[model samples]
Target: MDNLSNYFGQNINQKRIVVTGGTTGIGKAIAKLLVSLGGRVFVFGRDENDLNGALEVIKAKSFSGEILGISADITQKDDIDLIWNKVDNAFGGIDILVNNAALPARGIIEGNYEDWKYILETNVLGYIAFAKEAVNRMKVQKSGHIINIGSMSAEVKEKTGVIYVSTKTAIRGFSTALRKEINPLGIKVSHIEPGAVTSDMQEDSKEVQKEKIVSMEMLEAEDIAMSVLFCLSQPKRCDVVSMQIRPHLQII
Candidate 1:
């Protein structure tokens, strides 16, 4: 049976999943999809209040899957350890790792040193750190999947999105290499590149992000979230090397 839960999930019941930046926008959307499909999912957020609020809503659904939240800034190395600890105890082992946490992107021209550092810490290093952590457990289990949420900007340069584009480009390179390194060990790494998704990556107020959604014809967060599910649901013998989703009429 080709289980189809709207591409978000179907046969993924009880699969352990960890999604970073899952408090809102794309990450939250992914978490919700997983919950409805009966996957045990854990997510990280910097704000405890936001995290709790999202968790409450997810739990209220009371689906077969579990949805838990951890409050931490993924940019900090120490916090990654805390997250891992939760995962170790909460689910015992991780079957899927979604490196979805990222800092907002903006123009770069004599940018502030501190801002650049923050972006790099979260967008670049954090991704590698999580994979490293997951590998320790996944190798023992002999099977796992790492899905990196990248952007189409990695392939096409966009105006004023240089820094963000560069980081995603780095992810593209890193994911390809990481796959080669870990595939032999029974782990799968995939890069889900998206174009012009309606996400709050611009650091706007949540209210504003929501208001804009009513008018925009761009891809919804669910669009990207579904791709993630598709990758995870594939047959072990079939490796989806890469999947890119672009909203209609989006040039870049």
Candidate 2:
């Protein structure tokens, strides 16, 4: 008669989650889906207008779950502090943290020092900082999940976007090591690496993205969101360490 014995495993209802970069693209898709499934979702992005708009859209379809959003830059420590303060006030405690905020990068030689610095702060430091905050609270609770959105470019190592590839590779290493360090505390860490997802980061237009999806050259943002759901829905005894998802025809 135990609900946890169900084949689908844990229920998402009422779980408090924090999703960074949730204003658009993959993060937004994830926020929407998690809210629909009855998880209280707190999302944040750098743009105020976009954050407000996304909150509206997410709230429109939300039935039982709650959705809140804020305008903050992940790269700034003060902003990150403010975000956690708001989260603590809103949800009391967090059950999940989705580190999805990141900037698209240019090749190593294509940008100036400032540009490179900005990307590194936003993409790498931001993730670690947020995870630290989540870990502090989760450690006390002794139960939580951290889901990092990585990219297949980590392995592909394509020459076009060296900086991005490097950041993703770091994420790959971070996720693995973190899981080893924290799993004994009853916390789960999962890394999801996706290939060629259609999002605001892509140069393709919506029409082009749809065409590419049909051709099996691109995947929808929602596809990655579903993978996250799969990881979260698993039994407490099981941990989904890492997952790599790609389009059927995507080659490197």
The estimated TM-scores of all candidates read 0.91, 0.96
- lDDT by residue (73-179, candidate 2, tens digit) is 99888899999999999999899999999999969789988998899898888889988899999999999999999999999999999999889999999999999
lDDT of each prediction vs. the true structure?
Answer: 0.86, 0.91
State how far residue 194 of model 1 sits from its true place (Å).
1.2
Candidate 1 overall lDDT versus native: 0.86
Q: How many pairs collide in each candidate, listed in order?
A: 0, 0
What TM-score would you give candidate 2 relative to the actual structure?
Answer: 0.96
Off by over 4 Å in 1: 1-11, 203-217
